[model samples]
Target: MNSETTYLTDLAAVLWPCGGLLGPGDRGMRRRVRRDRGNQYLPVPSAHNPRVILPAYNRSAATRGITSFAQGHSLRERARTLLLTGAFATGMAPLLLRDRLYVGAGPGIEHALTAALDRDLSIAIHVGPPRANRKPVLLLLTPGGRTIGYAKVAVNDLTSRLVRAETRALRHLAGTPLRDVTVPRLLYEGEWNGHPLLVQEALPVGEQTDRPTRRQLLRCVTQITAVAGVRELRLSTSPYRHSLEERIVALGARPEAAPLRAALRRLPDVRVPFGAWHGDLTRWNIASTARRAFVWDWERLCLDAPAGFDALHYDLNECVQAGVHPGVHQWLDSGSRLLRDPLMSGTGLRPHTVSTVMALYLIDLATRYLHDRQAESGGRLAAVDDWLLPALEGLQERAAHEAAGPA
Candidate 1:
């Protein structure tokens, strides 16, 4: 079995120790597993069919689970969802065609789930693309097929930290007045079979529309930043910079250390506004509604981050995903300009030089990649040597050349 198969098998053992996963024609028939709803589970996107695993108990319930699981974020997402919906509608789901990845759930999951929520429900697990932050995300559905809430199971130390952080963030933001952004309500924060589990009330996400305007995006960022009031400070003395320095020091002999140190020395001390950021603000993590922008995934939320970080992150990630790798020049030129009008015009705040914020963002990002040991876990951006380090070095060279004018 491959890594994915291994992960699924291990997870199955935790969820159903007595009633384990089974393949086609496999013997040793544990009779008890067949009776306790163990036959209700299905493994998805396996050798039989590379599709999201949805609950296959009934057509209506399966359809609802599929639609909820696959939010129409892009054309590809929508197409896949439609195809799967059709498959379920016709009773031709891949699991029905073959028994390649069949799972049996014993009373363990139901007992823990019911004890946690005080209600019995069915579950559909979606393991997203393999990345450093990936974890098993569960959609809690009623017996009739309505998605009631969502749960995340942290399978490792990194994921466990993230799960706990999100819980804390939601609790902090709870009852806090957010103008146009809605955060998920924390329903339960506890452990499930030695793994940290977080259950949250699901947000009412709608179909995709045109991307939110720059004004709208910035407005949302502004509100998120104000959750903890923005502060003005020079980059040299700010807590944010201090934290980055500490991370570099902790990294010690890591290959990224020297380049990061050189880059830090390049930044000029300037006063800029610092505030909170959603940390992983991207297209996939946010949804649009007629009234407000619904954002989730608060595992990386930080209060002392630089202003304009979210806007930069949102735009930069879009560029990166489109195969347009941006270096320091793009960050200083268009990126800094992108923040000025949308973020500065009416707030009575000092205009942030896009370069300072951009440089700080780059450094902070590199620091996080190293701190989280993402490269070891196969994170796509973990190889900072290819993009981030070069950008930082370019920034350092430019700063040095500019300081020695008329050479």
Candidate 2:
């Protein structure tokens, strides 16, 4: 048996006691290994017993299948194919290859990575303080310590595609004005394992009070507008698509169906300039050391979107958190009013439109919270249930109140 086959067989033997097989059926654990020449499908021997003689399969057919699927495709597609074909196993691979997958600069600091500096460096892994998808990020930390960030893909099936798109988008931004706009610096990028890895410098954590201020938020909105005015920002692979709409649809087929469809149809009619708006712009993404507002998480940076979408997204999150706090409501109100004034002046986004969108968004957020009850019970869902959802509800109510007109 070849070394690759031997390695898989050994893994099967070790894991057989705990669980018979990794995935469905007893066709032996399969893995896809990509090399310079081509892709190879390596079948693992079953640990049941050596007495059972199964038919010998042609390795070439499997290799050809993998090669045909991977060649000329983006890294995202390649990764997806690898995972779906059972070539790339999750959780286990990271644990088994922990030594190769991670590098610890010091105690309490571990970064999942893969590198070849002279050639290309790519850091692929998911990151967060703990849980919280709001701040959950997939970062590519480069050689110079520069980092580019992307949003996490929700669907396991499309994870590969999402990663590749994020990588491509980041590389495009690296060459644009948004290159060094905010967050950590970025270096090289490529597919690693089944996810995209970007090598970048890590940013230092600062005091809580150092977060972005009101003026900084205004400035960010203005900067985004200026960028959009020059060129149309690309929103999605499919034209006129809104991620929010997708979320709403996913929440429940019936409760959100009509409204979401209507909102999507109306989205294109709205004349908001779209250019690199942060899809999820909350305080966490914006770090402040009491001097500058450093914005991160560029994966959701779409080219074309509503002018004040980021600002609204940010303020709404704050409102949800501290809506009941003294002056918090007034703060969100004033911020919303201001955001709609100066740069987004001509954009005619009505009160009803904002209210409807906010409501739909909140509902979607709540549904996600419900779906993750198990993870939450494990103490990972604290932020979402305790803070995010409440804050979002507040924003929705506030929007509805405003839409109702003068009291």
Candidate 3:
């Protein structure tokens, strides 16, 4: 079976241990037993539809599921949401859909969810491409189609760590006052079948298709950075730098990490402002409404990092999503622009500090990729050496050339 199919099978076993998957026309079982025990789901569009597993015969649930799943910032993703919405609105969803999964026996996730929320709840599962961070993201919906919360279930070690980290990050930021950005409120966190589960309040993501403006983005970043307050520390002596070194050493001479170590060694130990960053601040992870930007995916949130890191990350990722591969030049440009922003003045980021922070960011990112085995896990950034290391090495070369004095 393909990886997706395997994942589905494994997930089914976890969610419904006593349940058996049945085809659409399986008729050997007692009608009452099937009615009371099984939950029917139609794999929308096709059997292998990787987008959503819609609860059968529930238009409201399907619509919410489609809207939530297709909230990507990419044009292709937006087109998909439109297509699926159109298909369901025209009453053609059932006709075009196939390969229904009749999970024989409930009292699994549903039981736990109902007990936790103190109400009956149904779920629409979002299935995306397989990757290092891939996990079951269930949209908890009421029988009447209201989305109550979004639950993430960690099926492996990496995801387990992420699930716990997100929970802690949410709790940490709860006490901080934020005006420009809103984060998910931690609704519940518990364990099921030995796997960590985190449920957070659903953002009022209804019909929001806008992106955050530059001013708004800067405001949000500034607020998050101020959460932990800022500190000025040299790269060589900062706790952040020490943590990175420990991580690199843990990798222990892995060929993929050699360049990362070299880059770290070459970076000047200039003192710069360090603060918190919303680690994965990207267009897709945020929803912009008129009032504020709603950002999610907080597993990577770090309390100590160079100021303006989030803005720099957002710019580079935006380029990558737009089909422009960022290199050393892009890094330098972004870092420089961030230093010029008046909002960053409090963070003490200066023009001379750009290259140091730039190198630090690259090293930080490279070590993460290697440590997470992102490439091995089928992540889009599979070849860190091809894209990331080249940038780091190039920046090293540039720094060397600049230091040696005008040719």
Candidate 4:
């Protein structure tokens, strides 16, 4: 590729500021435009505004994979594989070892972690605000507060289940075909405070402005979702389908959740392709650098889900938080155009497939909110049932009409 040729990542720089506050730490991707020179390229200088350096993202050569390129993205892939289990785990290197000194006491936790990891620098532990359904995050930092990694623990039965699941998911992905795909590399997993603990390398993401539109983001996510297809086989029936159905029933039992429940019963049969999906593919869980989107938060990973659900989750996350209020129906209709047109163009799903996927996505969102472990924080989904259900039902009607297109 010529230095003058425009890379999709270069185009992405144009959209960074537009995707405001869309990722972890509520940080957005912002970039400065470079002047195109004939057959040549030069880095945009930071001699003017210093803030540009703070969100500084460097894009590598372009590729189809979302976060890292398989062909030339060896920087992240060459990470030293660490042993975290079985007999090989004990007395490991600093970055690979779990803190052996802190049994449970709070005072020595930082000391134990510092000694177990990096002894030379002074360290501080900061407990982050609780994430929905996950433990309060723990940030490990230098005395200057540069982050090393984030730590999570099985704080209770609920968190334990989630933490353990993510550990398994990362390990399951370690040696797989999509090994080069950008994902958090697990640093260590050991017990602390009578529960399981996991520490992972932190990867930051921010987007280039126009290179990845809301449309391109959807395409990028859908591209990565294909990893699940490569990683696992689609089952004739997934236990998760039953699990989601059961949640629908549980929520329906609550009189207030009746609309959400009723909507679930009307979904068209969807085609669920199997593979690992990030589970939570929202702006909050993904970051953008120049070349790829870094996806984190793997606890909800499911091996079986219809193709479009991850993209569906990403699109709906911010909306659900603001409540299922007015204009949501119109917004969903307008937003879904991508799925109907460019997203599924090459896949050959029938027109009815659109309606089914749409209905299922809404039902899945509602299910998540009704049970949102956030304890008083999850459901703006309750409001979604008001207009979105009817809106989804309309998809079915429209799909039927389109299937019988103008005589």
lDDT per residue as tens, model 2, 1-407: 54323333433232122211222222222231111211111222222212111111322222223332232235775665465335322223222211111111221111123322343222222221222231113333333334333223222323344445556555655565632245545554553323444444455543343456666666666665455453333223333245645655665654434543453443322223344566667776666544455665565566655556677667765654533343344544655575555544434344444543344344443444444433443333233444434555566556556656642
Candidate 1 at 397: error in angstroms? Answer: 5.7
Better structure of 1 and 3 per TM-score: 3
Instruction: For model 2, give the 10-residue run with minimal summed lDDT.
Output: 101-110
Descending-lDDT candidate ranking = 3, 1, 4, 2
For residue 230, model 3's alpha carbon misses the true position, in angstroms, by 0.7
lDDT per residue for candidate 3 within 1-407, as digits (tens), equals 56666677777776767674635533453364466666667765555545577776677888778887776566887887888877776767766765666676656787888898898888888877767777888999998888899998888899999999999999987877587788899999998778998899888765664777777778788888888999988778899988888899899878976777778888766777999998888887777876798888899999999888888787777656534455444656765676568877767776566656767777887788887888877776567777877677766765555445532
What is the C-alpha lDDT profile of model 1 across 92-132, one tens digit per residue? 88445344444555456656777899986877777766667
lDDT of 1 at 186: 93
Model 4, position 281: C-alpha lDDT score = 77
TM-score of each: 0.88, 0.47, 0.91, 0.61
Q: Which lDDT tens digits does candidate 4 get at residues 1-407?
A: 33211221222222221211211111111111212110111111111111011111111110011122111123433232111111122322222222111111123334445655764222222222233453434455554435567667555577788899989887866655342246788887877646777878767542342123465566565656666553222222555567667777776465436765555554444444433457777665665544565667788877656666666666665554455554465446644665666664443334445555666666676666556644343334444446555776676665445535532
Against the true structure, whose lDDT is highest? 3
- Model 4 residue 45 lDDT? 15
Give the runs in model 3 whose Cα sits over 4 Å from its true position. 20-36, 44-49, 72-75, 89-91, 324-332, 397-407
Query: Which numbered prediction scores highest in TM-score against the true structure?
Result: 3
What is every candidate's alpha-carbon RMSD to the true fold?
3.5, 15.2, 3.0, 17.1
Q: In angstroms, give how far residue 297 of model 3 lies from its true place.
A: 1.4
Residue 85 of model 2 has an lDDT of 35
